[model samples]
Target: LIQTVKLRLFLLLLHWFHPYLLTTSSNSFPSFPLARERMKSQYVTNICLLILCLGAANNTPWPLLIFLASLLPLLHHTCRVPGGSAWRGVPAAPGPAGWPLLGCIPFMGPLAHRRLAELAASHGASRLMALTVGATRVVISSHPDTAREILCGSAFADRPPKEAARLLMFERAIGFSPSGEYWRHLRRVATGNLFCPRRIAAQEGLRQRVAGDMVRRVGYEMERKGSVELRGVLERGSLESMVGSLFGESSLGREREEELVGMVKEGYDLIGTFNWEDYFPMGGLLDFHGVGRRCKTLAEKVRSLVGEVIAERRRGGLHSHVGLGEDFLTALLTLPKEESLCDSDIVAVLWEMIFRGTDVVAILLEWIMARMALHPGVQAKAQQELSACLGGAQRAVRDSDIPKLPYLQAVVKEVLRLHPPGPLLSWARLAVRDVHVGKSLVPAGTTAMVNMWAITHDGSVWADPWAFRPERFLE
Candidate 1:
């Protein structure tokens, strides 16, 4: 009778402790298959549970002890697991180690450009240096070769994930669209109509004519007053020239031109302002933040302006033809109303062309004038070239004359190298598939960017990278 009582007590203990043992074993196993085989026999778990309980009864504290023993492996594994591996198991480029969750947010202050340069200098070349500004990971690649590979390679051709695309494209702009058939088609159309050799040559005449007008306007201002507001004058003249050339008529009055210029400036200003929501997806919900509100407002204003232009063109009943100099609006409106080329398509393309073209030209002109003012030697050389080419026959220089003037061309190239309008060259592709870049594995969905600024300044590629030497072109 005493033996039967002991056996029943042992069975009760097994029943109580069997589940805990099984649970512990499953948790401890590295893989599912190992856990399954161990669990296949209930009798084995029962025997182990009985032995454990007997040990507990002997004042060994086996239950509590066993629980802790089961947990240690998991704890150790959790603590020892390394963070995400850098490209090809290469140690992440040495940058300031960031705080947990926040990650490098505190370091990026007002001047991102200076801060980035400083970081790159501190971190050795080809090392992975990363900063999480808000939620976006700003990975710095100090290698010009890497930058070139990413930009030229077909694998990385998509835009970075950002709010700018949605706002700028209105779900249709080609600049922000994914690189695919649609983008290819849009690019072909734009190149054929606007950027083709013939079209560009034709536009050169207009550009030269405008440049002449600009010089005259500056001279007038100089005559009126030794120092005039160059910014305002240049801004107005550039926009008017672009609009006039596009429409084949100067429909934009002073008030309208100023309004458009203000809108465009605001749009660009908004782009420069850091928006935390863009990098951190969840943060975007805070529309109260000025960036989100400003983007929406600017987008609406630009769209309305574009819509009005489209409406005017439609009302005029213009027909599209190749090589006819029909103007951008007329040429777009005249495209056969096919599924591929619709009115909305025309509007989006035209809007992008005007905004991008006008902004680039205006910025380039500003840089050229600023540089000329700063470097008297360069300005003198350029003036000499201009005089030699034009023979002082006219105050204005022609586009035809630009090719002949090597110094002028060199000046433009130098300005572009020194102050590239888009320093980063826009966000490039997210790797859609694994690509081996050197020893590093560019994982799928990794954001890529071409650091044009860095490329232009690479010491190996350019002599005296920092100096504003237009004579580099002569070499």
Candidate 2:
């Protein structure tokens, strides 16, 4: 009885003060959103605890818990129009006055990159918008200059790792890893070993082989199934390209290659998933949809599989015929004392390289193919460039032939501009320190995202932005 009366008193007081606290004027409502979200979460937690305790003390039914849980969606993040005080202390950049707690998440559609671009155009000023997603405040940039200002700055060096990313050891890889000595070491390894001129030239044969194998597989499928499903074909070929580059050609047998491909798909799926926990400070405690668990499992599998391959290379067990230069595995084995990485760290680097490139190649190729199918004129021009470059001979396309075909290169560039695989650059950068992007100030701990899709299609930046004209590159 005492507890129930106390709860009733608290509720009465909350109801009385709720309207005054959520005022429309900047002077009344609190501007700092971190404090605001904390307070809101605290209220919900306290109310739930009080209700549960009240029900237990009085030996009432468990339906009270159910009722409270049901009301969570309706109770919080309501349509409270905050004033110009959305982004804490400073005057916020022009953007939407999102719901009370939910912010702009509900408005972002399935294709969030496209939606973010739309939001920037409609609600933003100077191609910049400040909005909240769950509890995390993000500053979205849709212009190339502003994006370059944000991305190229040393302040935006670190990344905001998602819950799954952290679970999957994001700190070890170059993709989401912290900016420090370790990241620099990885970069150095990439530059000196994997991407050197001689090594890239050696990989020309590997690319040619992968392309040929993909064509053969497509032909076989066309003869057998009477139609070509390019994604799967592209996926397998891309997987071979990535793994083969890292390890060696046909290093893994059919079974292991299949396993690796499946794992890559799973990893991509997990990374692409927008977990609500990723947005909030303590939201990981909720662990929606078992994403954390899945990521953990995937991380373990990646380490184990890649570790096995590393061990094989260390033992001189895996053979190679794909390149003139030593593969990434051999380079890792022979690294200088200063640049050496531990087994786990090495696996993480390899995982980033492998998983990052595989699906991207497939998606980009699919886009290029689709564009070619849509624009036969452009396709003919590209083919003419290729034929002229190859001297009208029926032979395999070599890497040396790439530089000679400017029209084909333009077609590829146009395809990339039209449809970027990782349109948001796969992940957002964390603003480590306060920085001014143009006239607006992006504070520390804010998530900064570059909408490349927006910049690539912006009318101000490009001539006839929506048209699929490969000749634009020729000019």
Candidate 3:
């Protein structure tokens, strides 16, 4: 029944996007609401029926009752605040009105972030705006001041505790974990133990070794094929770097690496894909889109893989290789049992770190390289700067030499400005309480997102914003 319902929604989406995809003629009126303005009536009617059906299946009749009880008032345009008119005094920041209940969901295509950036750009000097998505209201902050108010402050620290994220991530991973004692503890442990300066310095030799391997692989490919696939090389290098840091370098071979990478990528895609279940709470129990089912399967696989590694480490103290002695697992194991985290917690932390770090580095590097390849003048300038810094030395540039290569650093920064891997920085942040960002008052429970892409591209904020001019950073 859930699958059938999902198919209906899928068809609705298809009709919403491309009417031609269905067998129906373009001239025919839509079976559902054709005018987006009046979709609220149909949206509520269908959702009520859906809730009743879902409630019957689960033998819990209260869900349908509860939804209708709350929805009736909204249908009558009752004031959210008692004794006051709707949204009185507290103004909703400017944005598209969208459809009645569905809000802007139908209009947001695959390039949603870019679309948002376009919206932000049109607002001139205004850095904050509001968007209604389904039942949720989202606040988009496109300026540094507004972003800092939401990010640096504690009022908007928590993430939206979505069902898919909680179920798959167990709400234990640092990224998904709510803002509380546990999250703070995890952050402290991660920063102090995993990424401390001392620990980083200790891994210098290991990083150098990985760099050597990447250089050799690139050289071999160039010599044999007369060219090299940069992305593949970078991806492998990134994976190896993270894997080597987590477990011993020998723990993952090329075959295992390829297999695990595929699994990880699929897992990421499934988790990231928009699930209607997330927006509407009733869909959580219904499994309407099978997103929850897929997440459950993927979660099991991830747990099995992470658990095996932990079990192996417990059985054998550390790898025979001295280089593996400083791996994160080894460090985790060394902490006093009373003070240390549980095995489950450790696994979540390590997996989250590895999952996030690997792809990001590769993506950023690929973007930088691609930009360099496109702009010969900028590339030449960076090379000249590197040559001046290195003084014609044949040896590879070391970490210590980075500060000396200003032009190269500028190029990297420019690439980051032009093409951030996560265009929407800190993707989704939920307000725990009513918060004031600049002049706007973001009510409690509002989902806020920083449009870093918008900030980076704003013509007022940046001179010649669209151009890929690395030299702009130098001045």
**Can you write out model 2's per-residue Cα lDDT over 1-475, one digit (the tens) per residue?**
9668656755664564444343343355443332343245455545656766676678765565447633643455443333122475655677765655667776555577776666555554536788777777788888888888887889999988677777675568876778898788889898888888888887888888989999999999999999999999999889888887888777778888898898888887887677878877777787767798899888888888888888877776434422365688777866778778888888888888888788989999998999989999988888878888878788998877778888888988999998866777454799998888888888888888888888889889999999999889999
TM-score for each predicted model, relative to the true structure = 0.75, 0.82, 0.78
List model 1 lDDT by residue over 307-330, tens digit each: 787787667666532355556666
Q: Whose TM-score is greatest here?
A: 2
Question: Local error of candidate 1 at 389, Å?
Answer: 1.0
Better of 1 and 3 by lDDT: 3
Computed on alpha carbons, the lDDT of every model, listed in order, comes to 0.62, 0.75, 0.71
- Candidate 3 stretches with Cα past 4 Å from truth are 1-90, 121-125, 223-227, 285-289, 318-325
Ranking by lDDT: 2, 3, 1
The reply for model 1, stretches above 4 Å from the true place, is 1-96, 106-110, 126-128, 223-225, 320-323, 425-428
1 against 2, candidate with superior lDDT: 2
- Shift of residue 351 alpha carbon in model 2, Å: 0.9
Please give, for residues 242-281, the per-residue lDDT of candidate 3 as tens digits: 8887776677577767866876676667666677765555
- Which wins on TM-score, candidate 1 or candidate 3? 3
Model 2 ranges off by over 4 Å: 1-86, 317-324, 425-427
Candidate 2 has a TM-score of: 0.82
